[model samples]
Target chain A: MSGYWAGILSILAINIIFAYGIFIPVASGQLNLGGAGFQAVGAYSAGWLSASFGLPVSVTIAFGVIVTGVIGVLIAFPILRTKGVYLVLATFAFAEVIAGAILSSEPLGGAMGISVPGYIDWYVSVIFAGLVTVFVFYLMATRFGLTIRAIHDDEDVSDLMGVSVRNVKVAAFGIGAALTGLSGGLYAHSFSYIEIQGFNALVSIYVLLYVLLGGTQTAWGPLVGATFFTLLPEALRSVLPATKNFLVTLFGETGIVAPPDESWRFVILGALTVLMMVFRPEGLVTRTMVERLQFWRPANRGVTQ
Target chain B: MLLLQQFVNSIMLGSVYVTVAVAFTLTIGILNFLNFTIPTLFMIAGMMGWALSYYGLPLGLSGPLPWPIALMGAVVLTIIASLIVERFTFRYLKTKYGDSTEHAIPLVSSLGFLLVLENLVRIGYGTDSRRFEGPDADLTMNIGGIFVRVPQLVSLAVTVVIVLGLTMMIKHSRIGRGLRAIAENPDAANILGVDTRRIVPVVFILTGLLCGLAGALFAINYGEVSPAMGEDIGTKAIAGMVIGGLGSIWGAVLGGLIVGLIEMMTVHFFGADTVQVMVWGALLLTLLAYPSGLLGHNTIGKGKL
Candidate 1:
């Protein structure tokens, strides 16, 4: 593969894993906005372990996943106490705190960032992404997933129906964190470097957007969302300049014919997000849409279930 | 005396935070929606003001206007942008499914707007920071051996007056009563004769006014404007909003000031690198330990997303 394609594939794989990490919590009715924090914990832990202790890649990645999972569970208890906007704010604050802590810690290399010794190629991350996708799908098919869905539908009613809302939420959050950590570890190894700036609030927001816009209904959502959004910029890279050239040709000569800015990609994404919410707030791949595709039942076209 | 000067400086910084925090708190408080575009709105005012003053109106409409006029034009543009955001996000909030994550639609759309507006600005104006040619921000006054920037003092007073005015308007005006009713219960207020659509736009208007004013003040005080300016101040404002407790104006005020104080003190003692850690750490602690905040009502922001 060309270097460009390889780079794109690696990013696509990492984003898919990261999206699922966020997807697990959102599916369980929790908006884990501090995704970058968990991912950072995973990446930095793996980086530090490899750089400082010279641990093997496998062990360090495992350590990263476990440590991030544990921290997620620890943070989940207190954070889950607040619901809705407070919950979102709490998670955001948690990420900022993690970033802040990472940036200031000396052994972690602070703002200088740490470099990992162990390196991995694109295939490794792709394999991990595939595994995580299957795992999440399997998870969603189990009784535990049913309980999470129940809790997501209505917490109090689920509680009345004998569901342990708190435990399920914490479990989902932890699993999501672990998955996000795994992706981060892969990112560090794949890129061969890790920095705090790479995992800022914007990354969290983008990952969450992938999950939310993809459809939180099923595991398919994140897969589709991640792939589409990840490739979108690459697609636009050629399209934007061509469109600008076309405009310039059509308009002859004018000051308005300035070269297209790279930021147009984000602008397009943002516009799509706004339009999607207006026309299809439920997301692009919803439960009903998935069901219709599977069953091919014309009568069930508009029926939700 | 140096500590005292730091304290005063913190207050000046806090004034900006307080304005933005109130803008954030107001939306969350009344509409029960966390508008992510707020920071973008703030940035718009500053960047637009700079653009207008430095380059005049786009397309040679006129020569560069005076700074104050430019700021006024920027504030007006920001209000229009806020209204545009409201039309898209808030207006389309309702979903037929009514699932737990239904509330996230507006939030997600606002995130889209955040990305769109901010990046559009980046495209229109280059990514680099520009010097804002405003009144001399260095004019200082010495009182008891403590130095205070004259512009900072004026801006601080303006912030105080605006907050007081907003509080009084929310407390005593008919519109305020309607807003309070809507905040208490949107459907109930609608049933009782409050125009949900009309009153909702009012919140966005106020949000734009507050954010624009804050952004203008920041430009004058800091003497620089940039596309990325909002991310730092916006996140800090969010921390202030949470620390003060979501949905409480007074809580936001206290929270903004507390955040400013923490930021200045951290810079004084631990260097600027640790400020993020301290401010975010304080926010995380507040969310975990006292979600209701100092002056916030416990019920606000607890609604399921």
Candidate 2:
């Protein structure tokens, strides 16, 4: 495949992992926005370890995932203490701190970021994506999943019902972080490079968006959200060359005016988000709702309605 | 002296955050949750004023005055933006999900908005920071070997005056008492005929206007405005609100001032880069230890969301 096709696949692959990375916590009634931070640590750890210690790619990836899982477990302590917006804030802060450290610290390769030789390929990323898809699907149907939903609906009631809210939250966080770390490791190798921007807070937002806009109810919501977003703008660029900058800038930081990629992009985009939430908070392609979660009949067409 | 200057600068930075925390607290308290895209109103208003100025619109071309008048014009524009966020985020979330599931949706949609808003600025203003040299006064002076710039000093005073005035207004004024009633219990306020629907948008517009004003003041104090400035400051504001105690108007104000001062003291005592992030980490620890913060709301420990 050409670099463009390969690039698209890699992007999709990473996003799929990211989508699931967010989905695990969110589905369990916890919204963790520190995916990119965990991902970055995993990526950098794997990158640095492989390069410096001459460890095999698989070993470094495993170690990176384990270490990040431990960090996730640590984070869960405070996260479990707070409810709602506070939890999101804690996770967001954690991610920001990690990103800041990555940017300023010299041993972490400073702002330039260390480059890594190709240790993973499109196949590896695709396989990981499959693993996430299968695992989440399976996990969402289990008894533990019911408890997670219970926690999501109401923490106090769940606790009253004998659910270990703290432990479950921690477990969910560890799982999410592990997936993110693995994805990050793959991402570092896929790009053959890593930088501060790779796991900045914005990436966390993007992953959250992927879960939300895709329709967090079923297995397919995140995948669709990630795939569509990752590709739609890129595909539009190739088909409509003149309007590509306009469309992309219309999405990113700069907006469409004169150069079409001006700073107003976010200002208007923010307004548009308000529009989307008001008009269609459910998402473009929602999950087919099946209250039973069985392999039985799929009732609702989308996740929301 | 350089150390002290950076410390002072951080406090100056904190003033803007104080305003933001106040605005955020005011809005959330009234509505219980926000639509997410609201934060962008701050950036959009300031950027609009900048855009108008860039287009050679006279400072007060909206009327027969100066830049401050234009800034108010921007505030009016942001009031519209707040309504927009309301109609979009709230209208749908309320319609589809009810009040309970509203938490994650707004923030996610806002993330989408943030991207668009920041990018709009980047594309419109060329990704580089825009130099905004507002009218300068020779008010900057040295206090105990610490130089406080005129704008910074003015911003500090303005923030204090605004916070104090608003606090008093909220605590004593008819509307203030009504808002307090509504915030304490929207259902009760509604039963007592508070006209919550009216109050919700009013609160949003009021907070948005404050945010716009703060953003303009921020532009003046910082000498340059960048698209990226809002994220970190916005985070700090959230932290301030969390630390000071959510929904406590006085707490928010005090929290902002404390955060500002701590930041300054840290920078003064330690190196700028080292102290800056350390302050956040320290603040997080303090808040965690205290749980609700200096004067924080009670629900943070509940873990309900």
Candidate 3:
């Protein structure tokens, strides 16, 4: 594959992993706007481990995931105490704190950022993404995932049914954090550089948007959401200028038409998000939709959801 | 004396946060939805104002306009944009799934708008910060050994007046009653003859007005405007809103001021790099220790996700 395709694929892989990282918490009905913070922790951990100790890529990436997972567990106790909008804001604040601490810590290179000593090929990340996708699918099929969905549907009812709401939320949050960290570690190794700026609040917002747009009802949501959005800009790159040229030619305007604005992709994304929420607030996919796709399996339809 | 100067400057800075935070608290309080496009609306006013004054209207429709007129035009544009946001986000919020993320429909849509609007502004105007040509920003007054910028003082006064007026309207006006009814229960409010369709837009209008005014004041006081300016201010305002407690206007005012002071002090004592950590850390702590915030109603946002 060409470098361009490799670059896009690598990014897509990382984003898919990251999107699932967020999808776990969101799937349980928590809006984790602090995704970038957890990601930064993971990235910095790998970057620091490789740079400081000359660690191998696997070791550093593993260390990154473990450390972020531990941090997630520690933070989740207090964070899960809040709900709804407050929960969202708390996560957002947590991410900002992480970014800020990294930015100010001299050992982390402060604002200068850090370059990783370890490097990984795009295929490594792609493989990781595939494994993660399978893992999430397996997870959603389990009893724990059922409880999570139960809690998501109605917390009071879930609690009344004897589900440990706190434990489930915390576990989901920690696991989500770990996955996000893994993605970050891969990102560090793939790019060979890490910067606090890349993990700003907007990153968190974008990831959350991906998951939400995908539909939090099932494991497929993040995959579809992330894939569509990550590739949308590339699709627009080819399509927008042509459409602009077509319009210009059709109008026979004498003035020079500027190339299509790069912002149109996001505008379309925003518009789609709005329309989707209005028309199909369950997201691009639904349990029924998934069931219908498996039309031959009428026996399995009763179990879906 | 130096300390006193920082305090005065902090108050001036806090006024901007106060305005934005109030807008935030208002939406969360009334609609139970965290309106993410608020910052975008704020930016729209500032960037559009700058564009109107520097580059004239879109597509060569007109030459550079006067500063005040430009600001007015910007506010109008923001209000219109806000109404559009309401159409996409608020109007179609009720979802069929009745799942955990149902509450997030509007919030997610708002995030969509946030990306769309902010990027569109970036595409229309370059991403660089530009000096806003307003009435002389240099005008200052000496008060008890501290120098205060006249524009900042005026802006602060304006914020106070607006807040007080808003409080009165919410407390006494028929519209205020309608809004409160909706906040208590949208269905009951509708049953009681409150115009859900009509009054919901009022919240957006108020949100637009507050954000627009804050953006204008920020431009006049700081003498700089950028497409990205709102992100920082908006986040800080969120910190303020949380500190003061969501759904409490007075709390937002106090929270905004306190955050402003904390930010200035962090900058003064710990250097600029630590402000993010300090502010966000404070927010995290608050979310843990006092999830309801300093003055937040215990019942607000306490429901399941």
Candidate 4:
């Protein structure tokens, strides 16, 4: 593969894993806006372990995942006490704190960032992404996933029905954090460097956007959302300049046309998000749409809600 | 003596945060929607002010106007942008799935607006920071060995007056009563003839005004404007809003000032690198231990989103 294609694939895989990490919590009725925090924990820990202790790649990645998962569970108990906007704010604050701490910590290399010794091929991340996708799908099919769905539908009623809402939320969040960590570890190895700046608030926002816009209704949402959004920029890269050229010619402008700015891709992404919310707030791949595609199965057989 | 100087400087910095925090608190307080586009609106005012003064109107409509007029024009532009954001984000918040995550539609949409507006600005103007040619911000007054910048003091007074005016407006006006009713219960307020649509836009307009004023003040005080300027100030203000508590104007004021104080003190004690850690750490602790904030009502941001 060309370096460009390989780079794009790696990013696509990382984003998919990251999207699922966020999707798990959203599917369980919580908005984990602190995604970048968890991811950063994973990346930075893996980077630190590899750079400082010279740990093997797999062990470092595992440590990253486990540490982030433990932290997620520990924080989830207190953070989940608030719901809705407070929950969102709490998660956001958590990410900012992580970023800030990482930026200031000396051993972690602070603002200088840490470089990892281990390097991984693009296919490794791709394989991990596939495994994660299957894992989430299987998770969604289990009794635990049913409980999560129940709580997502109505927490008070789910509580009345004897569902352990708090436990389910914390479990989902921990699992999500772990997956996010895994993605971050992969990102560090794949890129061969990790920096705090790479995992800012906007990264959290974008991943959350992918899950939310993809549809929080089913496991298919993040896969489609991540794939589409990750590729959208690359697609736009070619399309935007062409369109600009066409526009310049159409307008009969004799002056030299400046090359298209890179910001247009985000503009399109943002426009898509706004339009999607207006026309299909339920997301692009909703439950009904999925059910409709399964023509062989009886329509009412699995309609839980 | 130096500590006292830092305190005064923090108050000035906090004044800008106070304005933006009020804008953030007002929307969440009344509409129960977290509008992410706020920071972008704040940036718009500053960037627009700079653009208007430096380059005049787009397409050379006229020569560069005076700084004050340019800033006023920027504020007006921001108000219009806020209204447009309201039309797209809040107006389309319809619950189709009747799920907990459905409440996030507007929030998600606002995130979309944030991306769109921010990127468009980046495209229209380069990402580099620009010197804002405003009134001299360096003229200082010495009081008891503490130096105070004159522009910052003026901005501080303006912020105080604006916040006080907003408080009175929300407390005593018929519109304020309507807003309170809506915040209490949107459907009930609609049933009571509150004109939900009309009242909703009022929140956005106020948001625009507050953010615009804050942005303009920031430009004059800091003497710089950039596409990415909003991200730092916006996040800090959010920390202030949360520290003060969501959905409470007074809480936001206290939170904003507290954040500013923390920021300045962190810079004084631990150097500039640790400010983010201190501010966000304070926010995280507040969210975990006291989600209602110091002055916020308990029920404001607790509903399921």
> After aligning candidate 3 to the native by TM-score, how far in Å is the CA of A35 from where it should be?
0.8
Tens-place lDDT digits, model 3, residues B1-305:
88888998899889999999999999999989888899889999998888899988888999999999999998999899999999988886676656678878888888888988898888877789999999966787887778988888889999999999999999999999999999999999999999999999999999999999999888888889998899999999999999999899999999999999999999999899899999889888898899888999978876533
lDDT of 4 by residue, A1-305 (tens): 99999999999999999999999999989998889999999999888999998989999999999999999999989988889998998899899889988998899989889899999999999999999999999999999999989988999999999999999999999999999999999999999998899999899999999999899989999999999999999998888878888999998886777778888888888999999999998889988899889859875686786
lDDT of 2 at A51: 72
Candidate 1 lDDT over residue span A83-159, tens digit each: 89888988998899899999989999898898899998899899999999999999999999999889888899999
Any runs in candidate 1 off by more than 4 Å, and if so which?
A253-259, A295-305
In the range B166-209, model 2's lDDT, one tens digit per residue, is 87888799888888887677679989988777766777777777
lDDT of 4 by residue, B28-125 (tens): 98988888999999999999999999999878799998999999999999999999999999886778767888988899898989999999999888
Q: For candidate 3, write residues A29-48 as lDDT tens digits.
A: 89899999999999999999
Query: Candidate 1 or 2, higher TM-score?
Result: 1
Could you tell me how far off, in angstroms, the CA of residue B235 lies in candidate 1 after the best superposition?
A: 1.1
For each candidate, give the interface RMSD after superposing the true interface residues on Cα. Answer: 1.1, 3.7, 1.4, 0.9
Model 4, residue A221: C-alpha shift (Å): 0.2
TM-score of 3: 0.97
Worst 10 residues of 4 chain A by lDDT: A294-303
Q: Which residue ranges in model 4 land beyond 4 Å of their true spot?
A: A251-257, A299-305
Better of 1 and 4 by DockQ: 4
- Taking all chains together, each candidate's TM-score versus the true structure is 0.97, 0.87, 0.97, 0.97
lDDT tens digits by residue: candidate 2, A168-270: 8889888888888888888888888898776777788778876777766666778877887677657545545457665776778464444333333334435
**Local distance difference test, per candidate?**
0.92, 0.72, 0.91, 0.92
- CA lDDT of A203 in candidate 3? 90
Model 1 chain A weakest lDDT span, ten residues long:
A251-260
